[model samples]
Target: MRLHEYEAEEIFSKYGINVPQGGLAKTTQEAVQIATNIGVPVVLKSQVLVGGRGKAGGVKIIDNLNDVERVVAEILKSEIKGFKPEGVLVLKKIEIKKEIYLGITIERTSGIPIIMLCSEGGVDIEEVAHRNPEKIFKLSVDTLQNLYSFQIINMVKKIGLTGKTLIGVVNTVFKLYQVFKKYDGLIAEINPLVITENHEIFCVDAVLEVDDSALFRHPELNKRKLNNMSERDKRLMEKGATFVKLDGNIGIICSGAGLAMTTMDLIKDYPSLAPANFLETGGGITSELMFDCMELVLEQPGLKAVLINLYGGINPIHEGAKGIAKIIREKKVNIPIVAKALGNRQEETWKTLEEAGVYVIKESETQKAVKFLSELLGVKK
Candidate 1:
């Protein structure tokens, strides 16, 4: 769940991180009131979930009270990347002497969190990484243990952060890490972390992304929309199923969480194969439940093929075969299927499915399911 800018700042402030004085405004009148309260020379930022707000004229700095209403009125009426402004963030504009970037995110391959520091800030980090990769410094931290003081010192030295500014930056990151861990966050950053002329360091911009799986730990965030979940998401959640929609032509239904995740990962290795979703049917799937899962997959748009991979352990292969065969026969569906029913009574399961004209693959042939599904979808390997 990505938090709104104002909300991120609010959460940061609770952990002793300094942020500009700001409030949310849904109307032009409310925006002017916030500016008046914070005093003039304030910045008005459009509070939309999408990016490129500044380029789209969603951000403006006003020094005069007369122009606050008119400028904010225009911003409120404008849209940024097809997203209408839910509100505008009214903040006291800070004069930045220097900008730095500090953030924590999980390294995909290593599956560990790392604190990243960059001297080049206020610009997209991705742009910096691509153009000036050496400018960014990284230090991987073990979440199970407390952060070492030496790690901070090493980062301070590596980034050339020195003196009072160095001292302040170290303390701020210490607190920011706590917020990151406490919330089961996926990524947290204070980009454009600024230094004022007076040598005071403040995080001018904040971003916090919490893992949806850990939302039960933070009840207060219930008000904030997580991934802007749609009706399909709501239904999947109700069924206690893990289904993440992806842009692809093949839809997958597998048993077991670990197996489903592995299947999706394997699918990525084949460029011709792309999965529409990660749907896992837990242990002991009933006929009705199996039908529900199949129906859900069929509803997905742009889907060209479906694969049912079952490693029958607790849920017998016969039950899964009966369920899928019933759907094919009753619905009279013509969509191609790649069913891999392994373990107990696998022979009988394949027989049942083959009678329904479903393409039955073997345990040894499971590895070729991706290529087969790709061909079913008419994608060149």
Candidate 2:
């Protein structure tokens, strides 16, 4: 789960990391109050889940009460990356002499947590890595051992930071590592970790993503949930259907998570099939659940087609086919549906779907099924 900047900063401050004084505001009046409390010359940042808030005009600098009202009103009335800005974070603006980037993320290839630091900050790290790979320095930590002091010093030297700034950076890096380990975080990043003219370092911006699977262990983190879930997601959960929204035209429903993800990936390879959602109907799917899943997929405004990939593992293919047929008969769905039925009771499953006038692909190969679905959906190859 991704955290908003204010939430991440709160966690960072708990670990002895220095952050600017800030408070959250939900309205223009609240923003004005926060600015007044923190004193003027405050930074008003829109609190949204997505990035590039500054580019999206979600961030502003206000020197007084009038500017605070104007900036807050403008931000609250706009949306960034499709999410409507409902609140703003009011923080004390600070003078910066230099900027740097610091981040820690799990490395799949190394099988360990990796710390990434760069002198070129306030820009997307990925872009920096692609355009100037030499500017970024990376260090992988052994999960069994704590981050070493020498390693921190080496990173500071590699970034070309010296003197008091280097000492402060080293301490902040160790504290960040502690926060990552304690919270079971997937990513903890501070973009533009700035140095003031007086040689004090403070994390001016923060972003953290926690491991959803490990949330049960962190009750405090769980309580900080921002209720930013999408409307489609809430409806799917209420209807007892496992659904994950995606930017595509083809709606997919499968018996297992692995198979559903693979189906989406394969569809992407075809250049024609665009998966709308990742719907996994865990074993023994009832007709009602199947119907609910289909209805949820259809509710997507841009959905163009439906792909049903069922492999009999623990789920009986015959029962699943019956459910699909029932949904078609009852819902009167007009959209094209392509079904690939294989394993347990395949023959019966095919017969049931065929009887309902649904296009049943009899191929065992995923690529062939993808091609057929693409054609049916009018996806150009």
Candidate 3:
């Protein structure tokens, strides 16, 4: 689950990472109070889960106390990317001598945690990496073992740091890594980790995302409401499934993220058809889980068709197919339900799906399965 900036900063601070003094405010009065207490020119940042807040007028500097109410009220009323502000973060603005980028995340291809540092900061790291690939320094870390201080010092030195400043930055990296490891984080980022004219380093912005599957281990996080998660996503998460809702009529249920994405892309090959959701069941599958998935997706309004793409592998997909069959019978679903069941016990899986009146595709190619569903739904070019 992704956290708001304030939440991330709180986690950072708790781990002994230097962060600017700030507090979360839910109203204009609270914002004004925070600014008054700081007694310095402060920045009011809208607390939303999405990015582009700075460009969207969700961030403002309050040099005068008189303007705090108006600025806070204006930001609170404005919506960014269809998401309203849950609150505003009031922080004392600092004079920055330098801005640096530091982040740690799992590298998908290598399946290793990669720590990245860049001299440039306060902007999208992707944009920087694409424009100036040489500027970004990377070190892939094995999370199973300890991250040595020398490793961080060596990487930081390449960026031209020296003396106390270098030591401060190195220490911050250590603290940030601790936060990442302790929280079961998918992403622990500090954009614009700043050095003030006073010669102190503070994480000016933070982005922490904990793995949803690992939430059960952190009860404090599991009970908190996630602003970025939709109700459907939450329901699926609770059921040990993950679903990404989309804006189309085809409901997609697949066994992997890659396959679900591929199915969505192929479904878009037909001009009038698009995926309604991307549902991934991961490795663990059961008849009851499949039944639950079908029931959830079928509840979506305007879903004209359902597509189930599965690869048996080590999973007893034939048994899971029983759940789909059960739900179909119970709901009396009439929409075109097309399934492409491949791999071990493919015949048994096909039989169970077919018995529930689902159109089973024998082709191993996903494109053909999508084309068949498109035609069945009478999708126009």
How many steric overlaps are in each model, in order? 0, 0, 0
Q: Estimate each model's TM-score.
A: 0.68, 0.75, 0.72
Across 1-381, the per-residue lDDT of candidate 2 in tens digits comes to 778898899999999999998788999899888898888789889998777799989988887777898889899988875567658989999888899999999996676999999998789998999899999999999998878999999988998889998999999999999999998988999998998998898998998888766877987776554255455455545544566656577889987877887898888886645787789876466666676677777766556778898888656778777778887888787888888989888898899999987889998887788888777766666
lDDT of 1 by residue, 89-171 (tens): 99999988999999999888888888888998888898999899999999899877889877987787888878888888898
The true-structure Cα RMSD of candidate 2 reads 4.7
Off by over 4 Å in 3: 226-234, 243-255, 261-363, 366-381
lDDT top scorer: 3
Clashing pairs in 3: none
lDDT of 1 at 361: 80
**So what's the TM-score on candidate 3?**
0.72
Residue 233, model 1: lDDT of 54
Question: Candidate 3 at 125: error in angstroms?
Answer: 1.0
What RMSD value applies to candidate 1? Answer: 6.0
